[model samples]
Target: MFGRLRAWSRRHSKLVDALVVSPLVLFCLLTLDVYKSGPPFGRYIGIPATLVLSAALITPLLWRRNRPREVFAVVALVCFAQWVADVTLLPADFAVMIAMYGVAARCTARWAVAAGLVAEFGLLLAVLRWDFSQLDAFPSMSVFVIAIWLAGIYANTRRRYVESLVERAERAERERDQQARIAAAAERARIARELHDVVAHNVSVMVVQADGAGFAIDSDPEQARRAVQAISTTGRQALAEMRRLVGVLRQDAAGGEEYAPQPGVAQLGDLVRQVSDSGLPIGFTVSGTPCALPEGEQLAIYRIVQEALTNTLKHGGPGVRAEVDVHYGRGEIVLRVADDGRGASAPWVEGGHGLVGMRERASMYGGTVEAAPRTGGGFQVVARIPVGVAA
Candidate 1:
C-alpha cells in the first residue's frame, strides 16, 4: 500500500504537494496573529502572511525536483529566509527535506555534499539561538545532523556508481553483439569463396562434356558413350562436393563431417578437359612447369578460371574459340583466359556476383584480375596470383 501510494504521489507530484501544503499554509495563517501579538513589527499583519506565502510558493518549485539545481536553489533559499524570520508556525523543514532528497538523487556528489554542509551549519546556528533547553532534546543533535548529511553524500555517490555500472554493462553487450555479426559475415564470405571454387570447376567440365556428347551422338557412337560417362562422373563429383559445402549450415556439436578437403591448383587439367568437352573449342597452354601452391591460392586460381569459362559458355556464340594460358614463374603465376566471340556488337552486362567474386579472390592473394574487351575483337580476363613470398 505504501509503495503504491508513493508511486502515485510521484506521478501526481504537483497535485499531491498542493493538497498537502495548502491546508498547512491555511493553518499557519490562522495562528500567525496569535504568535506575533507582542510587538508592533510582530503584529504587523503582513510579516506572517509574507512568510506563509513564501512557504507556499516553494511547493511549485518542488514540483520541478527532477531539475535538481533549480528546485534545490529555490527551496533552500526560501527555507533560509523563513529560518531568518523565525517563522515557526509553518514547518520549513519540509522544504529542507525535499531539497535534500532532490540534491541527493539528482545533483552531483560535490553539489549534494556542499548543500548538506550548508543546511547542517544553518541548523546548528538556529538551534543555538533558540531556547530549547527545557524541551525534550537529544544531546547528540550535532552528531545526528552530521550523520544525515554524510548519509546523503554516500547515497548520491552510490547512485552514480550504480548508474556507471549499468552503462558499462550495456556498452559491453553491444560490442559483443557487433563482434558476432562481423564473425557471421566473415563466415558467409568464406562459404561463398568455397562454393564458387567447387561449382565453377565442376560445371565447366560438365558443360564441355555435355556439348561433346551431343556432337558425337550421331557421328561416333563409341566416343559419345565415353562423353556421356564423363558427364555422369563429373555431375556426381559436383553434387557430392556441393552437399559437403551446403552441410556447413547444419550445426554439429561433435565436429563430425566438417573436415572435408577442398580443391586446389592440381585439378586444373580436369577443369580444362571439362571446358574442352563442352564443345566451345578451348585450347589449354601452360608455359612453365606445374608446382604446388597453397590451398587458398589454388582455390583463387580455380575460381578465376571458372568465372572466365562460365562467361565464355554463356556469351561466346557459335564458331567462337577460347584459350586458357597459365605461366608459372619463379615468384608468381599468371592465368589468362580469352574468348574470340562476337565483340562490341554484343555489349556485356555489368555488375554481377561472378565478377565481384573473381576480384575478391584475386585481391585475397594480393593479385589483380582484369576483364575487358580485347582489341582484336574478343573478351580477355588476365589474372595474376603472387606465390612463394609475402606480397
Candidate 2:
C-alpha cells in the first residue's frame, strides 16, 4: 500500500504538494487574529495585506520541484516584505524554510549554498523584527535551517546514485540481449550448412541412380529395378534429414513433433555404407579409442565427412576409390577423407560452401580443416578437433 502511494505521489506531485500545504494554509486563515494590534506601537497590517503576502510566500511552493531556485527567491522576497511591514505569519516563515529545502534538494550545490545563506540572513532579520524577548529562538531556528539543508543535499546525492545504478543495469541488459541475437544468428547459419550438406549428398546419389535406371530400363530389367529402389531410398533419407533441420526451428512451439537425433560419430559407419551402396567404392576405418563428444562438435565432424564425400562423388569421376579414416588420439580426434580420383583437374571451385562449411564447422569447435589436392593423386580433407580425454 505504501509503495502504491509513493508511485501515485510521483505521478501527481503537484497534488501531493497541495495536500501537504493545506494544513499550513488553514493555520494562516485561522490566525488572522494574531495580527490584531492597535496603532502607534503595533502597526496593524490589515487582514487583506496579511492574506495576500501569505499567499505569495506559500503558493509558489506548488511549483518548487520544477523551478526550485525561482521559487526560493520569490518566497524569500515575500518573507523580507512581511518582516518590513511588521506583520509576521508563522506559516509564512515555515514556507520560506520549505522553499529553501526544495532548492537544496533539486538545485546544484552552488545554488543550494546561496539559498542556505539567504535563508540564514532571513532568520536574523526575523529574530530582530519579532522576538526581542526570546533571543534563544534564533539559534534553534538556524539549526533547523542547517538540518533541512543537509537533509536535502543527502537526498539529492542518494537520488543520483540510484539513477546511475538503474542506468548501469539497463546497459548490461541491452548487451546481454545483443549477445543472444548474435548467437541465434550463428546457430541459424550452422543449421543452414547442415541442410545443404544433407540435401546435396542425398540428391546427388538419387540423380546418379535415376540416370543409371534410364540407361538400363530396356537392356537389363533387374539393374533398372535396383536403381529405382535406390532412388526411393535416397528420397526417404533426404526427407528425414530435412525434417531434422526444420525441427530446430519449431522446437519452441507447443506440441512439436519429436525429431530424429542428430547424426554423430556412431552414425558415420551407416553413412559410409549408404554411400557405398550408391555404387561408390568407399573404405571406412576407425582407429584408437572413440570418446564422447559434444553434440555440436559431433555434428560438425559428421557434416565435414559428408561434404567431403559429396565433393568426391561429384568430381572424383569414374573408377574412383574413396576412404574415410577417423583416429582418436589422447585429447583430439582426427578425420581424413581422401579419394584417388581426378584431383586438381576436377572442377571443385574454391570458396564454395562445400569446403568452406567444413572449415566453419571445425573452427566453431576450436578445430581446423584442410582440403586440397593430394600429392600425386586425388583430393583429401583433414580435420582435427581437440576433445577431453575419455574417462
Candidate 3:
C-alpha cells in the first residue's frame, strides 16, 4: 500500500509541487510586511516592489520539474533585480537552491556545474546587497552550495549507473529466451525424426509379415502361424518404442511405471532379428571395445542404425546383404552401416528425412556422417561420434 501511494504521488508531482511552493510564496508575502517596520528593505525598494519581485522569483519554482533551466534563469534574474534595487532577502531565496538541484538532476553535467557556480554568485550578490555586515555568513553559504551541488551530481551518477545495469539484465533475459526457443525447436525436430523411423520401419515390417501370414494361412498352417507371430512381435516392439519416444515429450520429471529406456547399440541385436524375420539378411559386428556413452548419443547411434536398415528393407533388392560395424576408439565411437544392394543413382538423396536426421543427430554429438554409394556397388553411412573414454 505504501508503494502504491508513493508511485501515485510521483505520477501527480504537479500537485506535490503546488503544495510545496505555495508555502514559500506565503512566507515571502508575509516577510514583505515584516520588512515595512523591520529594516525598510535597502532604501530603494518599498513593500509593493519587494512583494512583486518576491512573487516573480518564487512562483516559477512550481514548474521546476518541467522547465528546470527556465526556472533557474527566472530565479537568478529576480534575485539579481532584488540586489540592484537593494531589497532585503526573504526565506523564499530557497527556491534558487531547489531549482539548482532540479537542473543538476535533470539536465546535463556541464549545465549543472555551470549553474552551481552561477548560484554561488547569486548568493554573494544577495548577501552583499542586503547585509555586508554579515560577511561571516559567506563560508557557511559556500559550503551549503557545494554540498548540495555534489549531492545532485551524485544522484545523477547513481541513476545512470542503475539504468545501465537494468538494460544489461534485460538484454541477457532476452538472449536466454531466444536460446530456449531454439532448443525447443531442435528437440521437436529430433522427436519428429525418431517418430518417423519408428512408425515407418515397424509398420512396414508388420505389413509384410501380415501378407505372408495371409498367403500361407490356407496352405501351410505352421508357416502362417510363424508369420502371424512375427507380426504381433513387431507390433508390440513398435508400440513400446513409440511410447518411449512420446514419454520424452512429457515435461514431468518423474520416471514412473510407464517409463521405458531409450535404445542404444546394445539393442542392435533385437533390431536385426526383427528385420531379419521380415526377410532381410542382416549382420551385426563390433570391431573394437565398447564404451559407456551418454543417453542422447546412445539414442542417436540406435536411431541411425534403425533408419539405415529400414531403408535397406524398403529399397534393397532381393537377397541384399546388410552389415553394421561398431568401433569404440580412443576419443570417439565409429558406427558404419553398409549394404550390398542395388543402390540408387544417389542413394543418400533417395530418401529425405533419413539422411537429414542422421546428420542432425551425429552433429549433436560433435560427429559427422558420410552417406553415399560405394564404388564397388551399394550404399554406406559412416558416422564418427566423439565421446569420453569409458571407466
Candidate 4:
C-alpha cells in the first residue's frame, strides 16, 4: 500500500507540492503583521504591499521542480527588493531557502552553488540590517539553510545512483535475451543439418532399391523381392529416425517414447553394408586403434561419413565403385570417401548442402573437409578431425 502511494505521489508531484506548500503560504499571509515592527525602518510596508510581495516570493515555488534556478533567482530578487525598501523580514522569506533547496536537488551543481551563495549573501545582509545585536540569529539561520541544501544534494545523489542501478539491470537482461536468441538459432541450424543427412541418405537408398525392383520385377523375381525388402527396411529406418528427431523437439520429456541412441563409429559398418546392398559397391576399411570419443564428436563423425556417401550415391551415376576409409591416430582421426564413376563432373562435388553439412560437422570437432574432383576421375571427400578437441 505504501509503495503504491509513493508511486502515485511521484507521478503527481505538482499536486503533492501544492498540498505541502499551501499551509506554509497561509501561515506566511496570516503572520505578515510581524514585519510591521522590526527592521532599520520604524514601520512596515502597507498590508497590500506586504501581501503582493509575499505572493511573489512564495508562488514561484509551484514551478520550482521544472525551473528551480529561475525560481530561486526570482525569490532572491524579491527578498533583495524588500531589503532595499527597508521592510523587515517576514515568514515568507523562508520561501527563498525552499527555492534554494529545489535548485540544489534538481539543477546542476554550478547552479546550486550559485543559489547557495546568493542565499548566504542575502542572509548576511538581513542579519546586519535587522539582527546585528543578536549574533545567534545569523548562525542559526545559516545552519538551517545549509542543512536544507545538503539534504537536497543527498537526495539528488541517491536518485542518480538508483537510476544507474536500474539501467544496468535492464542492460544485463537485454544481453541475456540476445545470447539466448543466438544459442537458439545455432541449435536450430544443427537440427536442420541432422535432418538433411538422415533423410537424404535413407531416401536415396530407398530410391535405388525401388528402381532396381522395377527393372527386375519379371525376369529376376527373386532379385526384385530382395529389392522390395531393402526398400521396406530403408523406409522403416527413415521413419524411426524421423520419430527420434521429432521426440527431441518435444517440450516435455515424456511427450515421446524412448528411441535408440544416435549412430556413431560403431554403426558405420552397418551403414556401409546397407548402402552396398542397394547396388553401389563400397569398400570399407578402418586403420589404427579406435579410442572412445565424446558423444557430440562421435555424432559429428557419423554424420560426415553419411553425408559423403549420400553425395556419391546421388551423383556417382551407374555401376560406381566407392571406398570408405577411417584412420584413427593418436592425436586425430581422418575420414575419406572416394568414388570412381562416370559422373565425376556432377555439381554435388562443387556445391550442395550435403558437402556444406559435412564441413559444418567436421568444423564442430576442430576438423576440416576437402571435397573435389580427383585429377584422373571421380570425386573425393576427405575430413581430418583433431582428437581430444573440445568444440
Model 1: per-residue Cα lDDT over 80-185, one tens digit each = 6656776542443555655665676667778777777766766665565463562234336656655666676677778689879979999999999999999999
- Root-mean-square deviation per candidate: 7.2, 4.0, 3.7, 3.0
Better of 1 and 3 by TM-score: 3
Candidate 4 lDDT at 284 equals 97
Task: Report how far residue 188 has shifted in candidate 3, in Å.
Answer: 3.3
Residues 86-144, candidate 4: write the lDDT tens digits. 77677788999899999888878888888888988898998887777886889888998
Per-residue CA lDDT of candidate 3, range 347-384, in tens?
44545888888888989888998887878888888988
Q: List the residue pairs that clash in candidate 2.
A: none
Ranked by TM-score, the better of candidates 3 and 4 is: 4
* Candidates 2 and 3, the one with greater lDDT: 2
Poorest lDDT segment (10 consecutive residues) of candidate 3: 342-351
Alpha carbon lDDT of residue 382, candidate 1? 91
What lDDT would candidate 2 get against the real structure?
A: 0.86
- Point out where model 1 deviates above 4 Å: 1-67, 70-78, 88-98, 108-158, 192-208, 252-255, 280-294, 327-333, 343-347, 386-389
- lDDT by residue for model 2 over 1-391, one digit each (tens)? 9769978999999999999788989998998786565533326668887778778888999999789998999888877776787764455668988888888888889999999999999888767776778889999989989999998898888878987997999999999999999999998997889889988999988877888799999999899999999899989989998987887788575575677888988889988988887778999999999888888788888889999999998999888999999999888899999999999999989999888889998888788999899999899999998898531
RMSD, model 1, all Cα superposed? 7.2
